[model samples]
Target: MISGLGLSTGVAEAEVESRRSGCLWAGTSHSQGAEVIAGGWAFACTADARGVPTWVPGGATSQAGTVPNPGAYTDPQGLFSPGARQPGTSYTDYCVGNQLVEGTNDVYQAVESGGLVFWKAAAPISDWNFDSNSPRPEPTWRSTSNCYRGSLL
Candidate 1:
């Protein structure tokens, strides 16, 4: 015999958005076919008649980092092409660098190669003032908001 029992139900809300508003801007590299998007915006890096990569901001200009280069490398990995697979290694070696904390000048990129994708982000070592041994003040993307929406199973 079974007593009165039932499964409990509740609603879980989820949303997705860009983690960092400007830490890294989204733009295409000067390649034949490469597409990059961030924060629900498409960054198109078009080339001029002379084959120079140009920055085309889809939504808003990024607060920090440099404009992306299109098609420069076949496998764009952390600071190095064919980057490491571990996310932590890439983030630390490139994004955070030797700095104690993450900086805004850090730039990130997504590369697709051999039917696989790689991600990398880095901040310029020069951005840190050696004399003071402190990181330069710049806008950074700590985390994204509203980037996903679904119910937890």
Candidate 2:
């Protein structure tokens, strides 16, 4: 039985294997403390409260890390999949180079980059209608868009 992870004989081993999976950074997975640079910023491999590894950007590391392809790291995701969610669904937004998007292809990619158009946190789908209108005007409202209606709650 693992000390911190309390599990019976059968499950303990499998749990341990999953726990050490490491952070997914750049275009690959990395172990804890492994650091890398993406989109011209600094990032360190770390784990979240749930123990899932993820990239947390910090001051550039001592070893000048490599720069990965911007496209691979920042492809927008759910922004196009209307079937995955409905119009009024809540979503997590991410920005790539000043443009806030609904979803991204890679969580790691959206998290970093050295581009002039740095990503700023985009507004959540639920909060688009703040002051009667929206900051991001899309072609249509009542549906999922970068700024669908910007006000529908």
Candidate 3:
């Protein structure tokens, strides 16, 4: 799930849509074999286990630079602490430099809500500048409502 695909339908219907439509990066859908740059990485719209269009790792974009550390990273707030990982869950996290948060290099978690996906600080809610008009308890960190902004983390 790349997030913000607007696929609220059941799995069967989504599977069919995946075959018909190409891959969806943020929210906007794209045809098969399309390439997108997300979070400083180059992603190619590829097929998944069920042949659903997915963002596959093409390579690191120039903006990505080098991965701070190749292997897994340890968040200051203990993101990788012992027993932090729950059973039967799939997630991937990388070292986010000064992109999301200003100046301070921190670890963020990619959480899904609605048809959109956004990253929030792994440290605490206090570190963020909340949107005054957001409807949820946690503020929406996105720049806009549209899913595909390209510059989003």
lDDT of candidate 2 over 19-41, digit per residue (tens):
45654432344557765553334
After superposing candidate 1 on the true structure, give the runs of residues whose Cα lies further than 4 Å from its correct spot: 1-36, 53-55, 60-99, 103-153
TM-score of each: 0.23, 0.35, 0.32
Q: Where does the lowest 10-residue lDDT sum fall in candidate 1?
A: 13-22
lDDT top scorer: 2
Q: Give lDDT: candidate 2, residue 136.
A: 28
In order, what is each prediction's RMSD in angstroms? 16.8, 14.4, 16.6
Residue 3 CA displacement from its true place in model 2, Å? 34
Q: Which candidate model has the greater lDDT, 2 or 3?
A: 2
Q: Quantify all predictions' global Cα lDDT against the true fold.
A: 0.30, 0.37, 0.36
List the candidates ranked by lDDT, beginning with the highest: 2, 3, 1
| Error at 14, model 2, angstroms | 12
Give the candidates in order of TM-score, highest first: 2, 3, 1
Candidate 1, residue 137: the lDDT equals: 35
lDDT of candidate 3 at residue 71, scale 0 to 100:
14
Candidate 3 collision pairs = none
Cα lDDT for residue 3, candidate 3: 67
Comparison by lDDT, 1 against 2, better one: 2
